[model samples]
Target: MLEKYASFCYDQIGSYILDSLDYFEDIRPHLSKANIQVSLPEYVSAMVLSSMFVSITTLTVLGSILMIGSGIAGLIYGMILSLISGTLTLVGFYIYPSIIIKSRASKIRDTLPFATMYLSTLAGTGTSLPKLFKVLSEVDEYGEVAKEAERISRDIETFNMDTNEALKNAAERTPSEDFKNLMWGMNHTLTSGGSLRSFLRERSDTLMNDYRRRVEEFSETLSLLVEMYITVVIVGSIIFTSMSLVMTTFSPNMSTGFIVRLQVLSIFIGLPMISGMFIVLVGGLAPGGIR
Candidate 1:
């Protein structure tokens, strides 16, 4: 009886330790949330994506082997290594583009509202539309937008470019519709001699309202998504935990026991994370207009 009890205590302790390790593994990817920035060089970013592909391919193969209950063959298996290398090269191409798009979107989203405000204020100040942009470009208060605006301003000041040319350059650089429309409005006002201040004022108000509405909409959508995610995590945790219990009940020496366990680990543990990432991507891609 004492021996049985001792075995049960050891099993329980082992189970707890495994559970803790699993929990950490699940949250590890999201623990270091990277900020989207425009600092990295294109080539360096590509290299990083390549590295991620290589790493993920190796991990997948090792994981798949574990899942299939296949032990690696003797020293330096060429087939596995070659397969991983090919997989990495294939996957790396797609990963870099996705990362680049996401990063660009993040930076654009951050700079948008401020650019609207600056343009609005510049318009309201009775400066000519081109001069307004010039003033904005010179201002140091804004970060990325200021840098971009300064670039536009330089084209005007140094290149002696027309307002339309400079504005078009700005729009081309950012690839944001907000700036594109701003350029359009400036061009229209310049050509037609419309009230630039009124145009900017309307646009600024619209952008602010749209920004608020987008935030509200995203909050509502994300609240629902979060609820769904939590439900999935809970249900999945329960299911895998039940499976773990079942595994514990069965003979530990089964040929494919560890494989089954790892598959369970991937599904229950890895799936929530993959789901969360898709949710974040959806949120990023959701169509939102800045008035």
Candidate 2:
């Protein structure tokens, strides 16, 4: 319903998107890769998201100011928060399609070696390029990459595009660099009279080695991150807590409110935000499977 409303907003609102077309051209490929269903023009999508977030943020800031404090200063502060929040919301909406593309790309990259191995094995049987993809597309075992191949096959068969054109389309829209390169390589090989099977097999082997090297490097980075987390969270928190306690113990005249407030601030405000940052970091680094 909210999605419909946003689209409606795009349609009913005169197009601010046309004036900002260049700002969103880079996102068009990602939109297809991410499978976002937007009937509106790319520009319209951006406009709708920005407008909606700003509207919501305005209401939220007004409510907060009314409920919590009142004055010119409060209004200014609230507007500042609203502007920041709204900007971030617009940024998130803008990047969300790209994020989805990257996620699918990660999943595709993780399984590219296996997918290539499968393709190589089929190519070895002397299957033509079109037939190979047509067969590959029917096999759901490769997951999202297989689905992508289906699109390629559909373009070639249903839309009457040539093999080269379909492959080019696939390469342009795929989130996976591996997949894009593979398509381009295959297309070039098919065009230039090279052996497709050997190319696929060699590519599969290379992709497998690359995946292994990345996993090892990622593991090493993870170890360093673990050490950093321990130092920052466990050691830092313990030290901070101890200092607070020691200060309270030594100062006989220390106010209980200040001591309690210090504890609350450290635990409630600091810890959750630190943990959240690490969580986002870990998730961003996590790409796909071990194999």
Give the best candidate by TM-score: 2
Query: Which candidate number maximizes lDDT?
Result: 2
Candidate 1 residues lying further than 4 Å off, grouped into runs, are 1-106, 128-131, 138-144, 172-174, 246-291
Native-referenced Cα lDDT, model 2: 0.80
Pairs of residues at least 3 apart in sequence or in different chains that clash in candidate 1: none
Record all residue pairs in model 2 with backbone atoms less than 3 Å apart, i.e. clashing: none
Stretches of candidate 2 off by over 4 Å are: 1-30, 39-46, 49-96, 125-128, 134-144, 255-276
Cα lDDT of model 1 by residue, 19-136, tens digit: 3343334222221122122222222333334444575666566656654555455213534564567566645543544554445445555556767777777666667655666777
Error of 1 at 265 (Å): 6.6
lDDT of 2 at 289: 69
Ten-residue stretch with the least lDDT total in model 2: 39-48
Per-residue lDDT for 232-252 in model 2, tens only? 989999998888889888997
TM-score of each: 0.53, 0.72
